[model samples]
Target: MTTTTTFDELPSLVGTDLGYTEYVTVTQDRVNLFAEAANDGQWIHTDPERAASGPFGGAIAHGFLTLSLTIPFWTELLEVEGVTAKVNYGLDKVRFINPVRVGSRIRMTATIASVEEVKGGLQINVDQTVEIEGQERPALISRGIHRFYA
Candidate 1:
């Protein structure tokens, strides 16, 4: 479920666990597209046949590709009302903890770690974990910094 709130309501969200997003499958085609877009067609991420014999035993999504999915997963978790713009200010301590193999499903759970008033808007610090289906460890984890502008 999405946690929808106005800019005024942001301050109250500190320490709120926003819950998880719906799962998204990582497909070979999606990996290919991301490889093309990122100009990082590494064998393990783009060449399935060759990768099948490589470590992880199959094509895997690029780390950045997995990280990029954070945006959509985040949107599914929270929505800030009355913001003219949203900026992906940055991330801290981002770690690709596990491989997202092609055809694997993944989802994210988020928490609002903090909410601080920034220059002209609000800065939301979120703790995020992207989990691969049926996996013990998460695929990725990070502290995502976002800004909502008036």
Candidate 2:
């Protein structure tokens, strides 16, 4: 995990990799729940039997479902102090590089990319990647922007 107190703290983080969280296994039940909540019930994500014969050979998690896990990953990576409000501003570039198969154990690696002063407090840019255990490629890569207000 990495902790930063000011914009200057960001520079120290360049090339530094944060630790991973305990592996969280992706399950069909969780995928189904996400699909139901997000209203994205695509066969590849919700149907196991059908997906077994489909591409990738089995049901895979939805890209957004995997993307949404970034919050939990971030929580484990850093601690924010002296902030009255913290909001997700947006994402810069996001890509689903690899499919997250059901039952796969996944964790995230976070790197502080940059930080700048904003209206309320500061805006931080973080480069985050979600990797599936034992996989050569990451399941997701994204630049996430967040705003912190005092």
Candidate 3:
């Protein structure tokens, strides 16, 4: 479920854990499209036959492809009631901890680490962890910054 809040309520949400999103399966089609778009057609991410003998044992999604999921995953976790615009300011830090093989399921758990008032808007720093189902380590860990305009 999503945590609903207004622009005025942001300041009170520091340290609040917003919980996890529903699991999403990563597919070979998604990885192939990402490879084409990014011009990063590495064997491990695009060529299934060759990737079967590669390090991760099969074709895997690019780390950036997994990181991009943070956008959709964030929407599933929180909703701001009074905002004219919402912008992904960017990420402060990120680490691709583990491989996300094609067909793996992933989900994210997020926390509001801090909220600060910026000119004409609120700037939020969110801590996010994207975990792979049945896996020990998360696929990605990141600190994402966002700006919400009133």
lDDT: the better of candidates 2 and 3: 3
- Please provide, for model 1 over 26-141, each residue's C-alpha lDDT reduced to its tens digit, 9 standing for 90 to 100: 99899999999999999999898999999899999998999999999999999999999999999999999999999999999999999999999999999999999999999999
lDDT of 2 by residue, 27-80 (tens): 999999999999999999999999999998999999999999998888888766
- Ranking of predictions according to lDDT: 3, 1, 2
Structural similarity to truth (TM-score) of each candidate = 0.97, 0.91, 0.98
Clashes of 3: 0
Clashes of each: 0, 0, 0
**Clash pairs of candidate 3?**
none
Give per-residue CA lDDT, model 3, range 52-83, as digits (tens): 99999999999999999999999999999989
- Steric clash pairs (candidate 2): none
lDDT at residue 41 of model 3 (Cα atoms): 92
- Runs in model 1 lying further than 4 Å from the true structure: none
Best by TM-score: 3
Name the best candidate (by lDDT): 3
Give the whole-model CA lDDT for all candidates, comma-separated: 0.95, 0.86, 0.96
**Candidate 1 weakest ten by summed lDDT:** 55-64
